[model samples]
Target chain A: MIDWFQKLGRSSLALFERLGRGGLFLMRVFAAIPSLVPRPRLVIIQLYSVGVLSMMLIVISGLNVGMVLGLQGYNTLVDFGAEESLGQVVALSLVRELGPVVAALLFAGRAGSALTAEIGLMKATEQLSGMEMMAVDPMKRVIVPRFIAAIISMPLLAAMFSAMGILGGYFVGVGLLGVDSGAFWSQMQGKVDFYEDIMNGLVKSVVFGFVAAWIAVFEGYDAVPTTEGVSRATTRTVVHTAFAVLGLDFILTALMFGSV
Target chain B: MIQKRTQEIAVGVFVAVGLAALVMLAMKVSNLSSLSDQDGFEVIARFENIGGLKERAPVTVAGVRIGRVKTVIYDDKSYDALVTLSIAAKHNQLPEDTSASILTAGLLGEQYIALEPGGAETMLKSGGEIKLTQSAFILEQMVGQFLFNKAAEGTGESKAAEGAGP
Candidate 1:
């Protein structure tokens, strides 16, 4: 039993090592040919997919999160006769952790999976092979554009999420709960720091984008022509990328903030 | 080909608008910060203990944040907490004999400094220290006291029943 457990652990470690190496290799390949691709066009496509398309989800989710936080936080603060601090609590929680992480996860599920499947289908159809045979590097042509797009998109989406969430908290806490709006905004302004919490969230989004794109591309490139293979790869890409993003978020948060 | 081109164009426009929205939001937040900075005052309070009183904790009057906690320092000589607060300049004139208390937001929430104004003719100036202060009410102690009181009540009730019995 012990030997079986040890073997399981070893296999898991080996799997992670392979993934890390593969991700690193893809990053390097894309990094080496920066100027070879059309930067502006790729960035525009990324902006559309990551930012504009993501706005509705970001807003809805952010508002609900903010409202729930305010409702819970206000109740607790009222007990100690410090209900006015609800604004600070809501804002800090939104900017520091919840907003960025949730936004990234949503983005990964919505767009990241699609990106992987699209690339996977292209691979299965021999299009990528044809591009490579014709001396058009797949990394520069397909992967680079998606990579650049995701990096740009995730941060912008996170910022939108944070802002919308704060507004939602404001409406629920001040308007619905009867807490003073002035007090709420003032407390939030006084307590929250853009450089520390908000900036950290943006940086995390950038990293998430990279992970999502890499997973999609890797799965797509390795996909078999069979329908089942494409379906499995797509599912794996989304599930694994989401978990990886969450795990990476915790490590980055700890490193950036130093024990919360 | 037309559909693809149009989709790409639509996406491009969407990205522009999203970026613009973020920039505007940032500008608005910054503006709000500056406005608050221009109009605020300061006061000082002392406490026995400030459990989780952060630097930017709100100072509320009737559940309104008229001020914020500026700093917290330990005074070894008096064994007290010296908390400085920044109030909105308009609300600067506070009664001389005000009471300051350390309060928790919830069961496990953050703590803050609460100011209760006293009925006095004279107003306090900047750097003035509030003398009458209350420390945070520890939850464990409160729960312990309640349980003990309940047990005592039960014992007294049983003794009275024994005395009344044949």
Candidate 2:
């Protein structure tokens, strides 16, 4: 009984300690931002690696997801003699929920895991320490640029995802199925409001990006400097980011789309 | 140096394409392009009941949308629904005595305000009140009235049958 109680206490304490460390690490990254502004190249390069590289994954997944939505929606809507509303259903589902959530989840697995692994490997090889020895702030040079790149790229990727998804939906809805092209486009335009639906979706993606990037970098920086440790940190980054993105999505949806 | 330049170009293209997608979403998918860039005047109409008539619903004339429902408010004193409409400036020549009625799009779709022109010398200006207005047809009320009529008819037929037998 005593051993079990002690174990529980130890685990709780460890959890709190890790949370505090992560919070402080995030603060350091924020603090490094002003210094980072002078050098845009670092951010640009990171953007190329993180944002540009992930484009294919986001776009492809978005298309497939949208096509699936179109197929499923058509089948169900046809039963109720509401196949005309397929466009509305597809656009609403993609813009309001799936677009941001799926993009962020993919971003976490793709760019996020890579970020953790890269940073962990750098630590294992003592590159961070080498920079520190040269009187360079690793946070400013290394972490901040990557973090900013993530923030910049996320909304753009999500926007692209939604756009591609809409196209995919259109192709499936109009081209494959016999739904009227005019009706599909007109219905989507009439129903989906720019502010209520699109802007709110952008907001959700931005938040997800922030959280995902934060977790990725923090896990990497905090990893134990060993080969096995680096692998573990990468896994942790992906798992933690996935959970955070999904949980935050629900909260954001409630706050943004909840009122009406 | 060449490698660096190509990479930078790729990044630029990526950003541009992404922004283009956002624009397409705004212009093509959503109502931003259609609704924005127009300064319109507001007009008011009162209805007995507005039945699912929401704000931002289309205000149409002869099946053509000219404006949108700006606000829907309940009048405390008259117990009527006062709806404000924002009509585009280009459509400024609508007659003052135009009739406004609530209409549904499809069988069970969105409700919009339909306006019919009247032969009047005067034209509707900002804040002008449309005098002739029709309320939305409530489905439940219609069904209830229908059932009541059927019951009344049945009772009358039974009474006639009893009288004939006696």
Candidate 3:
């Protein structure tokens, strides 16, 4: 029994070590600068696909989340005769914890998976190897444009999400719920600090963007150049990047707010 | 190519409608609420504990927002929570002997100041202080006290049973 337990522990350690090495490799890929400049056409395509295309989903998700939070918060506050505090509850929750993190997760699932699949297909077809033979850098030709696009898109998406969410909360909390609209706005304006929560959310999005792009690209590039391998790589990239984004969010929250 | 173009247009229209709805909602919310301004009349309150109390938390009296908390500063000399409240012009008639308490809206909710007006004839002025204040009632402390009391009762019951058995 003891021997079996010891073997299990060793296997777990090995698994963690492999995951750590993979993460480091992805980070290095992100840090590497390409010799050739990314083409404007590629950048535009990436921007459109990742940013503009993502707007509807982000807005829909953000609005619903806001409405739910408002309803739940109002219900709880009504018990204590503090129904008016719903504005602060909704605004603070949206700005601090939900807005950036949820947006990042959504982006990772959608754009991040698409990126993985595209690159994975190229690798399976030996296009990446062919480009290398032609003295063209695959990372420059492919990864950099996507990386830049993801970084640029994430902050904009997060900002849009936060704005929509606050509006949604207001509609449900004040308009439908019969709470005075003036009171809600006043409470929200007084409590929310743009510098502290909003700026922090934007900064977190940049970091998440880098992590999501890097992981997807790395997984796609290192895939076994087979059809089955490409599919597996795409799936793994989305799952791993999503979990990593959530984990990093917790770490950043703890570091930023723990001492306070 | 034509089909793709039409599909793209449809998606664009959908997104535009969604964005418009969100904007309309925002305008409605903004128009409805009134926030207290800084440089207004101030009132000070004391609290033992203020959990998750942000600097700009609203100070309400009987569900009406009369003011906002300007700052939450700890006075070393007094060893108490010195909360500075910024009251609106309309609510400037708060009595001098009004009681202030640190209250929480819900379980694990944000903390705020709840002002209970007193019957004093003299109204508080700018930079005046509220003398009577109650601190936040911590749920954990209450639960701990209850458990301790229950344990004491249990011990007393066991002691009586032991004596009767002898």
DockQ of model 3 vs. true complex: 0.08
The C-alpha lDDT values of all candidates are 0.76, 0.93, 0.76
Cα lDDT, model 2, residue B136: 98
Best by lDDT: 2
* For model 2 chain B, the run of ten residues with the poorest summed lDDT: B33-42
Better of 2 and 3 by lDDT: 2
**C-alpha displacement of B164 in model 3, angstroms?**
46
Order of candidates by TM-score, top first? 2, 1, 3
Q: Please, what are the lDDT tens digits per residue for candidate 2 over residues A1-260?
A: 99999999999999999999999999999888999767999999999999999999999998999899999999999998889888889999999999999999899899999999999999999999999999999999999999999989999999999999998998999999989999999899999999999999999999999999999999999999999999999999989988999999999999987889
**TM (B chain), model 2:** 0.93
**Top DockQ hit:** 2
Model 3 residue pairs with clashes? A181-B32, A181-B33, A182-B32, A182-B33, A182-B34, A183-B33
Give per-residue lDDT, candidate 1, residue A87. 82
Off by over 4 Å in 1: A1-17, A36-39, B1-13, B20-32, B35-166
Q: What proportion of the real contacts between chains A and B does each prediction keep?
A: 0.26, 0.85, 0.02
Q: By TM-score, how accurate is candidate 3?
A: 0.64
Error of 2 at B94 (Å): 1.7
lDDT of 1: 0.76
